[model samples]
Target: MSEAKGHPPVFAIHLTSSATDGTRVLAVGAEGPLSADLTDEVAELCRTADDPGRAGAVQVLPRPLRTPARVVVVGVGAADPAGWRAAGAAAVRAARSDEKLQVVVPPQTSPEAVRALAEGAWLAGYRYRDAPDGPRSAEVDLITDDAGHAPALDRARALAQAVWWARDLTNAPASIKNPPWFADQVVAEAATRPGLTVTVRGPDELAAEGFGGILAVGGGSATPPRLVELSWRPDGATRHVVLVGKGVTFDTGGISIKPRESMKLMRKDMGGAAAVLGATFAAADLGLPVRITTLAPLAENAVSGSAFRPGDVITHYDGTTSESTNSDAEGRLVLADALGYAVARLDPDVVVDVATLTGANAVALGKGMAALYSHDDDLAAALTAAGDAAGERMWRLPLPEDYLEYLHSDIADRHSSPARGAASVVAALYLREFLGDRVDRWAHLDMSAPSWADASDGDLTKGATGWGVRTLVAWLGALGR
Candidate 1:
């Protein structure tokens, strides 16, 4: 395997009036006039092409008479923000290996639409390669004269870069992404920013501080475990929000080994950690006026003699003893410890934890949507709106009081896994037990299904999709406003 950690290619975006020397991309609506540069011949070609001017449709024409050697016409059906985004992505993808592109923005497009277009273009251009000498992204020029769209374009670039950083971390091979290495990468990235202070606690510190859940889950791995705290404390910030993420670098189900097919994408088990890290980085970059603290409990649940077995009762950081009915259900174990620590020591006004916690989430919400569990109606609404705005949709699931008995343990205070079904709900209920009295201020995101994609779609690649970063960043931005 290649030692290089795959980083997404960067696209240099420019706002210009004239088309560049490379490929020219035109956005055409189903019922609108063609771009001025397009001749009568091209208009006739579009009229005859099947599904021309439909959303996400792409039609490439080799224009011998045009200044640019080739022209790509992308459909912008109804010209909405979503349509514009899809058009942008389809345009860049049609450009293929071209290193430079001039994309024509539709007339009278709003600044929000312009931002969406740029985001979709930049995100679709992302390609993660294991080799250092992999192909780079195209230099894109948004052919428009609207100077008011500058700030929106800049914001789009920042958000895209944050998502790219998250995807890079999540896509890194398990061979080089153990707990220590993960901590090192996060620390190195944080060193570049001034206000973001990072502290990493190793096995000794974790044991001494009573981080039992984290240590127990990581006991089987030779690389050990780490609890990483990243803080951004801005002056005059009234609300303090703490974000905890499960950072299982790779999971083999420990003593309860998983089937071979289920373990192939275990390298992406740390996607939640990547999402929180990306949101924090975006917050710092945007200089949001909100105090944010992020906790990532890192571990690898491998199979070994030292592995914590099923039926073992382990004490979590808050001194709550939990029976491990299934060693494979380890994400919630680490998240519980981190959430408990955050509530006890951080004095947070709000707490949100994201984790790839349960396969049952997929069963309930399919692979495209995430499972959201929160008792606070206000918090649930804010997150749902944020997710909708960011294009990472989430459906709030109930934490029923009736199902609390499913987690009952005869030998311990509570159990990690339930003997009955409703595994996703049970996992969230188990995590809620560690939140102390802050249950109303806490929200949990089970992003197990949406974290990785089976194939490349609109803004998602085949590997890590960096699901929760956008939603968290949007919500934080709203809070800052």
Candidate 2:
């Protein structure tokens, strides 16, 4: 419940052969470990406790034991990367009050498992607060005799840092996070990385460039809108991937209006942009051999006399016309301009856009998964595999050609938010119209459901989840390789 003024510290991780003089964490398998490399008293206590060893289950010893006074036992069901990740997260949460921890790495664990463990622990330890009483900083030591796992740990640390940065950006209050402010934050962050370059377009530039969709959606707010173009062009990079993110800093549904309850979490409407920025930063930090271009369209959809209304026909960046059927569907409108620009200017091998575009995504997939739509099977499969590896699961939805008729508008080339049912699909179809002939290279992620968590889960806190970051980072890493 406490707040902190600045970013929280990332967990300090080290590789060691034995437990440090602090909290010692032991892992238990689903069937119970046949032999645990632990003190006799600790092992006996674990047995007497009757722990089931299910993934994410944690148990803390009641009494202090030896050099490492505190002891915590976590469950790693099936002993896979997912299980190890869950176990690592559970152990860290159980001993969150402790400043130091020694986590026992299972014997002969693969580098993937080690990376998962480090990522889980680092991510679980993240807290966004503005007071001195917030979550305390902690350091973790992965107890293992092998030195080869160090590289994996390093990669995990970088990925975790990227996710944490996304969470911070998404969780920031809307009052202080307008479009220009968001652009400033991203520009400042990109300045620190040597390989990244950021160019921000303000209201004047947007209007001059004929980005009507972005201008229309942002007209209601006094602060105006911004389009941030972030690029990372590494030498000798072969593939160019363009990422577009919807950055509705706060959405009041803009004249269509959301319920008061729905507006409570509108601050996180920029979650997609946060994820894009995070992935781009991660690529630079990890020195990935891929040319990456990120387009973030930022605006605040607030209610005012100047707000664009339903039935208004607006021209987009590529001269395409769209009739707004519902102002609440503003995310897709802004994204249309960015996608149009990406297709027109950036000649990339792949284009992926992430957005919290529809509430129907939550209705269909619930809060733990995102809805993925793509015409390209290879890209879909690649993203699905990356999500599986990164713990950010996504379900690919069918983009039926028959649904294209639903977007038919009498006044314009397309209708934004044309149909009521299959809302997520309709939104995806609307955005697809902007991709031009590059439709096969485009993929859309409606991450509304998973972008913000209502409850704390493994590697996810209750607020902004930073959902797409890990998946995007994983996919980019694979592409670079």
lDDT of 1 by residue, 1-481 (tens): 1111232222212111112486334423322323455545456567667656666777666755434546676766656666777777777777646336667664566898898888888878887756679753445678676788998898888888888888888999999999999999899989998899999999999999999999999999999999999999887788899999989999999898999999999999999999999899888888888999999999999998899999999999999899997899999999989999998999999999999988999999999999999999999999999998888999999999999999889999998988799999989999999999899999999999999989988877788999999899999999988
Worst 10 residues of 1 by lDDT: 9-18
| True-structure lDDT of candidate 2 | 0.84
Top TM-score prediction, candidate number: 1
- For candidate 1, report its TM-score: 0.91
Each candidate's clash count: 0, 7
What lDDT does each candidate get?
0.84, 0.84
* Model 2 poorest 10 in a row by lDDT: 9-18
RMSD of each: 6.4, 6.2
Candidate 1 stretches with Cα past 4 Å from truth are 1-39, 106-108, 132-136
